[model samples]
Target: MKTTTTMLGLLLGLSAPALAQGLETYAEFPKDTPPGNIAIAPDGRMFMSVHEFYGHALRIVEVKPDGSTTPYPTDAWAHAPQEDGDGLNGVLGLQVDREGILWMLDGQGENQTGRIVGWDTNTETLHAIHYIGQPAARPTSFLNDLAVDREHGAIYISDTGDGANSAIIVVDLDTGRARRVLEGSQFTVPEDTPMIIDGREVKLGGNPAKIGINPITVDPTNTWVYFAPMTANSMYRVRTTDLLDTDLSDADLANRVERYGDKVTSDGSTVDTAGNVYITAMTDNAIGVTKADGTYEVLYQSDEDLPWPDGFAMGVDGFVYATINELHRSPVLNGGEDASLGTYRIVRFPALSATVSGR
Candidate 1:
């Protein structure tokens, strides 16, 4: 437990909380983000997904440590352009493997297809090693967020179908095998409403197209899979043993579930090596964490342009990084035809109990 005590003098408010930098804004993309999700690569690179409608080509950008960035450009491996129209729409999720490679949830999208792309850090080359949106079993389900378990070479994604429903899609990176698990659970709906922080109601996204289980995360050891519906207040978790085995159907896996407990209204989630689950409380303007014991706490809050803090991932320096997609702050979310997107801020907070550099 490191305690970083940055002077309240560095930021606004003489009475601001005594801690390390609350939120440090990074990048703010000019595009809209329907539901934002972020991930940190093993090498410290950052990946993000923004705006379901126009989130194709430029949606996912890789940020370097020095702040310079280069787009992971490719029609199939990268985000598809908005002009491609519905048939080729691509909004994605990302994960980094143990070998320092990045894997993408290439939501082949409206075409009812998706692909998992692998990018080699050493070569800066993109490889389409896994493809899911095939004709045999095209569900056209919402392929939202992604989490990878390096131990078993598996990746889990949230289907989040258009019928306002949810399901977990598992990809065996080793075998290129994919399947759905843990279906039909209460936590999969958009109105599960168990999220309670300081007794304040966590407001789920009220957007017309919004529905359940938007953000998904995994425990440190990959034992528990945690997820929440974008508009739902409550949160829940189920064991991975049930999700990984093909013999057990989603209905059967759903039966072995457990409630991780409620959270404030949230948009995205991530976990660290310590078994702590971090959630982006869109309504709280703060990041929340669920400890190993099932109790939760507000880890930090943003004071700057950090209006809507979204997806989160821990960086190499023990800093928790997040995409402050500022969805609510976007014009479309605000009900305007040409809504300006919020700053795609990538802020960092010190690890638990970590104090300011000088403190």
Candidate 2:
């Protein structure tokens, strides 16, 4: 296994070790057990979701500083329930909000309905469960990512449909009402571009598969929601006020969508306090940051164990944590059996200058 250990240089006024100048493997998962995303609370407790593709049987778990893992809230929630209207079926996107609450976005799965659950970190109890039911959620809807707009009692989610029905779902925390917007619009659907990883095309069943509207982020001011397709290079944003207004017609909402900037092939995303958006650049095996002025720069690139930096969480401790899970190397995408070696990793670097807003 190749590991690059060096203190990282400080960027954006944040100090990092030289060995870990850009990427640091903070923790490692057992071989074949890839993590989905990482969420760090205000108290520095780190939690991660297990990717269903790896068959971990657990939805989410907490990572101790010593690297031991334990299920969060309870063991039962980690092993999610299968009923349609109850419990989490799949957990992909997770965020720790300003109020010390952990928000979980459960995507559509077998016998599982799309839902968002909020857990109060202090109480260690389920605070709220908002299910996206009926016309807003279809069987094809793959709720891939989320951004919370706590002040407006709303949560924005990206429904990365099965290549044909991509859209954005906005949930009202107050009423548990979820609305699907921009369904099948050019802004939401994936382009016909092939996904490349490790200089090779990522294929499923001998055909290249593309992910649509897979990355979403809420700016620190809670004013805009930025998103993009995992297989595309363009990034776009829409005002939070516009997203929450039910009166706006689909045409009106689509018109409000603003092309923020161009990004590398990205998976998960998070916004820092200064309005800079950091994206997990999977193809480049690094993290990329987009400034408020719509300019982007490769903040950190690595060629070591960080083969694919998939998901991200801008931590309260001024470190941005990511799940270095190489999805392209999974057996399901690799003609039945994975021949890859090395452990799945969780890496972090000094990141956001402040806590993420909108719990």
Best by lDDT: 2
TM-score between candidate 1 and the true structure: 0.77
- The parts of candidate 1 lying over 4 Å away from their true place are 1-21, 26-36, 50-57, 73-89, 134-140, 192-210, 302-304, 353-359
Off by over 4 Å in 2: 1-22, 82-87, 352-358
TM-score of structure candidate 2: 0.89
lDDT of 1: 0.61
lDDT of 1 by residue, 1-359 (tens): 12232324454465453332545555545443333566666566676655554333455555655555555534333444456442224555676665767766767544445766677765777544677754312364667777777666677887777534476778887788888654545767666344433333333344354466678877666677778776665677777777778787666777777777667667788766666667877666677777767776776664444557767766667777777655553444544433334455567776673311110
lDDT of each: 0.61, 0.79
Candidate 1 lDDT trough over 10 residues, lowest sum: 1-10
